[model samples]
Target: MNKIVQIDPDQVEDVGPLYAARKKVYPQKVSGTFRRIKWGLMAFCLGIYYFLPFVRWNRGLAAPDQAVLIDLPNSRFYFFFIELWPQEVYYFTGLLILAAITLFLMNSVGGRIWCGYLCPQTVWTDLFYAVERLVEGDRRERMKKDASAHRWTLERISEFVLKHSIWLMIAWWTGGAWVLYFTDAPTLVKELVTFQAPAIAYIWIAILTATTYLLAGFMREQVCVYMCPWPRIQAALTDEWALNVTYRYDRGEKRMSVKKANDLRALGQHAGDCVDCYQCVAVCPVGIDIRNGPQLDCIQCGLCIDACDNVMKKINRPTRLIGYDNDINIQRRIEGKAPIYRIVRPRTIIYAALIALVGGIMLYTLATRSLLDINVLHDRNPVAVKLSDGSIRNAYTVRFLNKRGFDRVVAIDIDGPQDAKLHVVGGDSITPDRPMIVLGRDGTTELRVLVTAPSDRNPEKSIPVKFRVTDIGLGEVASATDNFVAP
Candidate 1:
């Protein structure tokens, strides 16, 4: 007994414009516990990024000596003592999964901690802001200079030039450091200085430099507010218990001047501790009023908390009017109850367990993975040929990888078609009775091979064939399966 409902598609109107113009945010600077933490983290992150490529590891003479490198030319990735082959790309997949789960776990306990603290965008933007503050002055002075019409004095012009020059230098270094991960850092540096590096290297550096300059210098908060999808995702993933930078309206309502609040308290009337100062908003990188409750524009950076706490201290009142808080805590405060924290909840536990499980699996696989590998592909045309000696012959392309540091002699054998003999097409060193070839150190070799079986012992149609390759020096064996066909 349901009524049918129909509407014309054209009848619906578009609600509103999909986008809005951006407002520039000139964030004021503040200092406190969070600021100090930010400074330390920024230094650590930038130091590792810029200097780690130069750190050498003793990886013998033949291999790259850098601690970490992606040798695209050789199709290898070297990380300290560990080396990865092209077939082992799944390790990167596992690492990506671990990183995602770790981010989720971090979010379940502390909302947007990645965005507020560790995100590359935030770190670079913070560095750029530090440079800007150093050259142009603090928030108020910068704002005043921008607002005045006749402010472009020689000193201002000089500051502008200096600030931009420094920013460009930092950006160039950032790009330059990235290229070091692909080659010998010292060698590449020498080549780059002498204009002898490859054109592609220069192209990549230029692209990265432009992006870093634009995104960190000009886009800044705009990238956090409008461009990034993490804020939206974090909002969806957050629970009531996830601590975020919050303004406690319970203690901040009925905001007034300090004298007015004191007079009201003396008269036995309620007056909020907030002095209606806009310091919190002023220092916010996104220029959001945290007092207006949770908003997507708020990055939970904790700068407002520092600004509000400083203001509260100046007024001789209780601090932490703004702090790392949650909705449940806010509600508890409203009901005159102590706030509770539940960091070990179901979601957090699940995320942590997933991270641990994936990490353990990856470690186990890496520890026991085979260093020798083989692959076989049957010939496409004339898969089987009748030999003049009344024998059935089949051609194959065999590829083998030697993942060890030294050379290896691998003996190849076939396990199908009775009385079958193996032969390498152009290898003079391989014996007709027991075919073997030398595999180079840490490389792959492809060779054409043939298998012949007597007509009396040949299979009728197609039969499963197993190609086994045994390393004579290391006693390691690898096998691959293909099909043997008879004409």
Candidate 2:
């Protein structure tokens, strides 16, 4: 891969204002099985994200007590049972790949499940809606209250204040919870309250707070419809067989009043189950009519299913005119054939296999990962130096990471040269010149070393030399190889 070195690693410019003005989104409050599931997931996700950093796991006396931590200062990631240094960043890359693949799999089977349920935007937006309903009222009441002005009497003022205050409180808490993941949570909380936290911490809190409030409280459904890219990609990825919150227009259409439909059915004319109550549209958070034939704006949250079911129950008709279904299945039903569902289609199978492969690889690697790490850099500019006695020498910068919680002795040696002398600067060369080096607990140390080969021992013009680091305490060995150049 040709690296875009000029691209700033942390900077991606926002696509400039595509729309002249932001459209207001007043997501109607919904109650149904899907809404309840969304609420449960929201609470669970937020609970874990906000409080997990406070949970502790002991890793002897050397590691941080936090269960999950991203220590930017020390360049370490600590989970409940795993500690990762900079060298282990590849594991994170692997995880991201797995996560992306899982998202694709979810899209193939169910269509943007992440967007509908697990995405932070959706969760937070749902939370904001709940708060709004509690403080103000349901959709009709809220819309009515907004329409009238002096209706913003003292009571309205109090309710509005209470609502915004709660929204901001949640936003603030969300921001506060985020910073806890980076440091010791209990101590950081105290420091933050006393205003002793770092400037960067405060800056990050402000950024998160503003974003959470705006995105969840103000932007709401517009974020899903316009701001998020998933809907557009989901539209592209979806097929005829993928189950989505679909309106079975085959049954729901020829729409008319219950009395009118009953009259037509009695007369032996075409009639359908729908009562034309518009409950389905009213309950939709995204506010798109599923009867409009699966528009991009529909989140498929399944609130319509609940509303239609309720309507069906009240009117003594069949439920689920709008349900989790697919075009192919609808066609089959229309043709008087049994509807078929293939959850194990090629797309879904590929995605599941990839997920399994990546998950297995990650599990295996995590189970058997080495506790020690080593890195080597050969000195440049003067690749080789001719010693006084005519032995050719190469200098190397060696770094060793001791992941264990106790100090240990390590023996550094060279393996490729038959008569080469190894010197660990500031180290003991005792008992057959076994260069002794010490590593601190859960820390890294760098040392300069000189490897010299006698003129007669130079096997080739450029000989590959293997540098071996062996932990005396555990017999664990790691090696790096580089070419030794001859003058």
Candidate 3:
């Protein structure tokens, strides 16, 4: 038997709500070194993204002229002078490894620099903030308008409509620009304007438009804080010596009013340079106060440094109360010692070495890669058959790849059992042992081949047979090996 126990409501303590509602952030505009750098990078990145597809490269008559194109229909990827096939997907793997190592190197040098300066989210969100500031006034005015009694005034409503219209237009064009990479840019643009483009193109445009608008225009910093995985990964990758956006609390402590601080300093009492100004918080896009120390929310964008510098200049105090600094520097200042930076540490050197090794390997392989290639698949149903003439025959499906822009004639030769004769079922042979086939430009040709050998020469067990394809004119060669078995 168990006794029932009851808990009184009065004895229970309220732990508050499980979730906190999001606080709207209104980032104030500021101009300084980092801001200027962000502006320049944003322009450069957006320019490349919007216009790169229009650049053309001549790849002969039958090949695509687009400088960079993913030709899904032909299973080809063209990048300027280089063309990749499905079998060469190892190049993509190499590229991904290089990218990951580069990111790690960057993190080891500066915390979250990519997220702050180069992320698509940061660039587009900065653009959206500019538009918001232009239409609804700066941070304070926007806040006031939102809190005003007449929230939906005619003038304000008109501004809202204008702002959203511009945002949608930018978002739509962003999506439209992405689709241009798949086809001829100028031709696709004309077709799109005339509503004659493919249904899939329009569908992708719609999807990208919706995502860009929602993410850049509205979601803003939320995407960086919650949606992205880089922050967590960077946290694990970062070291104590890595430079990050930090408030120099050693110099900015014992906060007081600017006038109070000046008076205290005159009396030989120590007062920090910081005057308790909230400007740093106001200019931060993520609304994180750098003085609270580094947080997961901080993107290390250095906007707070700009904001703090502006305030320090106005108050006749030394700048850099907040800056890109490491924890070692902060502790050194407290210990009355000089701060040192070690950008060429062990991890950074290792990352750099790995990047170079991988890059060099890829470059070497790409430069020496063969344009002519072959694959051979032996028939499974009847591995080998003995003919009435006491000859053993083996069938194989051989494929020849002509990666060149022009058609080529290739000769297929087999090296296997003694006294073997190679024959292409429907192909003409330049010699009795070698069968020649014409391969079309930038395509593959499949042929049914029979390799027959005298029964006495056939091995009791399976033997390795090599199929070699040689370009008749250029003498380029590629080979593949398959087993020839006796039934």
- TM per prediction: 0.94, 0.92, 0.97
How many backbone overlaps does candidate 3 show? 0
Off by over 4 Å in 2: 1-30, 428-432
Q: Which parts of model 3 are misplaced by more than 4 Å?
A: 428-433
**Local error of candidate 2 at 8, Å?**
50
lDDT measured at residue 440 in model 3 versus the true structure, 0 to 100: 90
Q: What order do you get sorting by lDDT, best first?
A: 3, 1, 2
| Residue pairs with backbone overlap in model 2 | none
Which residue ranges in model 1 land beyond 4 Å of their true spot?
A: 1-19, 428-432
Q: For candidate 2, report its TM-score.
A: 0.92
Candidate 2 C-alpha error for residue 79, in Å:
1.3
Q: Local distance difference test, per candidate?
A: 0.90, 0.85, 0.91
Give the worst 10-residue stretch by lDDT in candidate 1. 427-436
Among all candidates shown, the one with the greatest TM-score? 3
By lDDT, the best candidate is 3
lDDT of 3 by residue, 167-200 (tens): 8888998999998888889999999889999999
